[model samples]
Target: MIKRIIRNTGLLCLLFLTIAVSQTSAQESSNLKEGKVSYITGENIYVRFASTDQIENGDTLFIRDENGLAPALLVDNKSSISCLCSKLGEHTFKLDDIVFGRTVKPVSEVVQLQQELPEKDVNEQVLITQEPTKESSRTQDINGRLSMSSYSNFSDEADNIHRFRYTLSAKASNLSGSKISAETYVSFTHKLNQWDVVQENLNNALKVYSLALKYDINESATVWAGRKINPRIANVGAIDGLQFEYKFKNMFAGIVGGSRPDYQDYGYNFDLFEYGAYVGQSKKTENGFVQSSLAFFEQRNTGNVDRRFIYMQHTNSAIKNLTLFSSLELDLYKLENDKPTNTVSLTSLYFSARYRFSKRLSVFGSYDNRKNVIYYETFRNYADEILQQASRQGVRARINYRPVNGFIVGASAGTRFRAEDPRPTKTLSGFATWTKVPTLNASLSITANLMQTSYLDGQVYGARLSKDLVSGKLYTMLHYRWVDFQYVNTLTNLQQHIGELDLSWQFSKKLYLSANYEATFQEQQLFNRLYLNLRIKF
Candidate 1:
């Protein structure tokens, strides 16, 4: 049965890919339209229109202010009703500034207008191609996803267990142009035949990922209330109070005041008040761009200082075909002799760089020296505690080559070491992908990895076949993997096999459904999982 399923999946992949490739040219047209700048916060400008369905990342829009059309703005991201834009050059803009998408006027009309206008005013007339107009009808933009999953485990020595989980994420904005936006995410999980435990752990099962409202006070400033995560200072995680940001040319500054979530269950905790401020600068160089930010945070518990730290992050793409990113966290407060003292200590550091030698070749490397993440409430086992104490300091390097169109080969190596350990864990991997298989219109990838650790060694190999069934409407993928592990001290060996199948269907422009099934086998043990998700966009 498994073989039959695999064969059928392969046939479908090839058939779908063939149709998608043949219809690619017909889907190249766009329906983008003009939008107006509703508000601006720091370098992030919010442009709103009737619908953002046709807008896409990297699209350019001309911005017009009192001084007429200024520089263009690049659409960095978009939601259902708004597009987040960044300035492409040194152009000053204000609130309610007009923005226009691409529009073409008839050559004959342009010539007539120019001929009738004075030479001095010809340029001004030429600039009046199109202006952004506000939509008469106000509509609230809403989008979200709901997902459910089930897991079952089978073992010879232990009774079978089953678990169910559900997750929800939603975002709503505009709400009749009141300039209000809110987003939220929550999840719940429970084991089968464990109603009592589920009731007892209800609080832990439900987590409010984000519940935030954003309001634009003016052109250059905005405030967010409630829990929100800011990408500018994402290393600080989520903030539970207020966030304010302002922009000045190529520089930006922001401040956040909030309380950290409860460490135990990720719930609201008023006693863990925290506040921070950050400054960042960004500029485009001749070849690329550079951005950097620095922030300082202070956290207090019960009105007493609990932690103080400084974070710095920087990214540079100023060199052609190359990118560099680095960040560091330093603790400013430490406890000594049961007394708090100001002492600087590096807590975490990461650096990464990627360089594309050419269209067909690229290399990337990274180094990370950070302590392992630990959840105090969940650290019940000795292994978990030991792993927390073992700092995960590692370095990885990878290279990829594409000798021909739709074909790629890559290799990578990495190692992790701890100060207390004598030997480091090393890993090596290689992979190949062929999107164009001669006359077959399908994609296939194979990957293999070998790992050597102080206590054990392992090898893993996998393959995947995937294709888009109906252009952007439907997709399918099948994957299989084999793993072998050998314990160095115990002289024990184990092998496992895993297989997965995934399917996604875009029922319409606003609705989507996806499902996944996975199974694993190891000797007499078996594990299975099923997942389904539904998403909607407005």
Candidate 2:
């Protein structure tokens, strides 16, 4: 009986090897195809650029950044694009003339399959299985502070300031392989700063600022509501939106809220709210898999008119230890009041990659191309020009290393290309930090960047911005706290510095105290913020 079992196991192993090899070979052949672009549902487009690339489904990708420099890829679908390729960590592909950019609706729910265990004698085969354990899939963090602080500024106003900020969050696992979570952020400030009304309001308001829920249908899929970071649409990650994330095997997908349109003159400025959706995939291995994502979003006001954005991306790793990725984005405005509010198509493309020559040294860079085609309106207001949405391409590169835990150092540089203009702005920056101390932790970071930026209208020019972020804290087993610092220099020659010291102590379970002091500097004016807070269980 044992002998028979051994024979059966050997046969199964042989079969598995054959299938795995064949799958790899087939993917390699597809990636080797020269000059062809075909979107494979669960993977990236099969490419055969220059004839010598070996790629496969789900392989890790490494390539150059856009501008045909660093490492990156193009995977967006809204903008019309041709002649593209990607780095697949150890392979590359030439995007042939094909359908790589297009809109696709959501598909049916993914079917859940039961795990299957093959019958085999334990003595004959070695089984490598991941350990299963209970997961703390849910968590809640509370930030409370208590202290005494005072603020004195350029003005003789001796108004006392008190402030408080708090947050609560929770999460739970879902049956569809998804998880659900929610949170609320609240702030309170009395005797607010008069310099920036909006900033002051935000700093002093004690209201539930945001709430969110997440639904995961599978290991690689999700849909969410409330507030989320808008990815590659309208603005980059900072713009939060009501959104969704989907991952089909290796192919990718998403949709997020877009920017709303509002006019300040003639009461035209109505807070414009935008929404978007996108899909794409990426390769993370050397077997020639691909990485990409396509997305779309829109803004709506009563239904009379709206705006939209489409984005796509693709990336892979190639030879020479190079990684590459690229992206394309489009912005469109429409009006229900008329035909389509004026429309502008802005297309952006960039690529980047990095190479590690040693354990602590490596180089990376990226290039961008942004072109905005306006259908009609071009105005002459400096604010309009400076604040107006901008379209430009640029390049960015960085190199860094870590000699040990809690410490890192690096330097980076970047340059921009404007669509409406013909000049480029460049910049360079460097910084370092360390947090090796236990119980007490601290770190400092600084960066300097220079490039061309636009105002409300559309014209690109040179400017420089520098930033410094730092944090420090010390505590024992019963309590702990930290201080925060920040600084920013604008290209319009506007400069500002901010410093804040805070402390928090937990007297015992369910009770705490916190306090903070802040100072701000802009031009020749100086301002400050002060607050103290406490919490206790009844």
Candidate 3:
């Protein structure tokens, strides 16, 4: 297995090198153009061009910032004079940043219609061809963040616990004007004072969240290797091997071949080989946009068929002020008598929608009929097992209303039903927030929750206050909550109180620090926790 992996990796590298050389040769023989950033919005940046006739939808654009040229935008929608772009990286920009578009193909390849034109038409054509030309250059942007956190916990029955965690995330792309790119996110945690119980679970203290490399063969097709999650098919989770995708107009198709991570600790293993394929389409309408995808996957455990399923997802915003999303998974393979059999069964379903009635009012709702995820290796007790096995069919709805400026009120309700369970669980919650207090530089919020189930009923009340001390540099928050629970069968009641304080400081544009302290009191016992984190971005 290791030899095969190495061989595959080598082959992919050679293929990418070949493509990069070819592209470089072609680019040297062609010309390029430039555009200028004209406007910026919360979700998109608009670029103005002399004439956007050469710009394509999937083309990439680089923005010149203080850190040099960075390929930080992707062109999504365009018109003859302007193009809409979405940011691909975190880069702050002001007005009139120089935007460099892709290299233009050779003019000889462009088709021309030769004819005897009128005298007036020839003059207009010559004027149109006299516009200024710009040169295209390659971009290399390396940026990411590093964070370290320390956590300490104190309890009555157990010894004081302390842990330190460090996380690193970075991306280096288009290095030296090549299409090669690599990204990784990894974290590790260590216990300051190891205890027997803690040591038993130390195997999970290190995790490699993602490590992937991508090679863009061209504007319309790309390939990726290693463990990475594809945004278009996020429901399928991470793929551990290779993925290839191609785009056409408003549609895309892709294939994935990989091995699933080990079941015990999410590490590498050859027994869980899997493969899948998906196709999707997206389009923008007069009102909004919509996208949908369908995928089929198969998995094996030690050369034996383990699971096969089909997944479907859809998202829509074509209706004014309304957004909708839904996804479904259906099992296509079942096991009987230690043999695989064909069957059709709905495994999971989820749907969510939101609508804005006006500038001051909005509502959102969601429904899910998926079983709760269960990890047998991590189960601690019978109650945990029971909760994992319980069917997680539930529906929730929330609404927010702003009666006046700087003040908002919201309410939510939810219910969950389990199969063969006579009693269902229901909950209701409400909150009110005042962003700008009359005489103070602080915001305040109050919330209440009521919950009922077959075994227990509870009520919780909470309040929080937050203030900005130094405009955008420093902030502080304080919160308190009270909870009361009543057991139905035993007719017993319990009460608890909790409090927390949080502080954050932004020292510079690329550095931040935060600290949190929390305490809980129940039945004459107390528990406390403290957390501190520091992060730096590049």
Highest lDDT: give the candidate number: 3
Query: If candidate 2 were superposed on the true structure by all CA atoms, what would the RMSD be?
Result: 21.4
Give the alpha-carbon lDDT of every model. 0.61, 0.36, 0.63
When 2 and 3 are scored with TM-score, the better candidate is 3
Best by TM-score: 3
Q: Candidate 2, residues 302-365: lDDT per residue as tens digits?
A: 6544556676655444333454555666777655575665566775665555455543455666
In candidate 2 the C-alpha lDDT for residue 466 amounts to 12
- lDDT at 48, model 3: 55
Show model 2 residue runs off by greater than 4 Å: 1-164, 174-210, 215-225, 229-248, 252-277, 287-289, 315-325, 332-344, 347-352, 368-394, 401-410, 416-426, 431-538
Q: lDDT of model 3 at residue 210?
A: 66
Ranking by lDDT: 3, 1, 2
Candidate 1 ranges with C-alpha deviation above 4 Å: 1-140, 152-158, 373-393, 438-440, 468-474
Model 2 TM-score (2 dp): 0.43
Candidate 3 Cα outliers beyond 4 Å, as residue runs: 1-138, 195-203, 373-393, 420-422
Tens digits of per-residue lDDT for model 1 on 1-538?
A: 6635633543353344334333322111133354556443322355654455665554556643221333356564554445555444323454334466544445653333212111001001112211222342334545444556565655565677776767555555554456665566566777788888757754456566666667756556768887777756767767789999887777879999988877887767778999999998877666656777899999999999999999887766677666667778999997899898999999988777766575456666778786554442231222212222322348877776767655667777888877675578887778776654455455667887777777767777888766556665566768887878787789678787888787776666545666777777878777665656564433
How many clashing residue pairs are found in candidate 3?
A: 0
Can you give the lDDT of residue 77 in candidate 2?
14
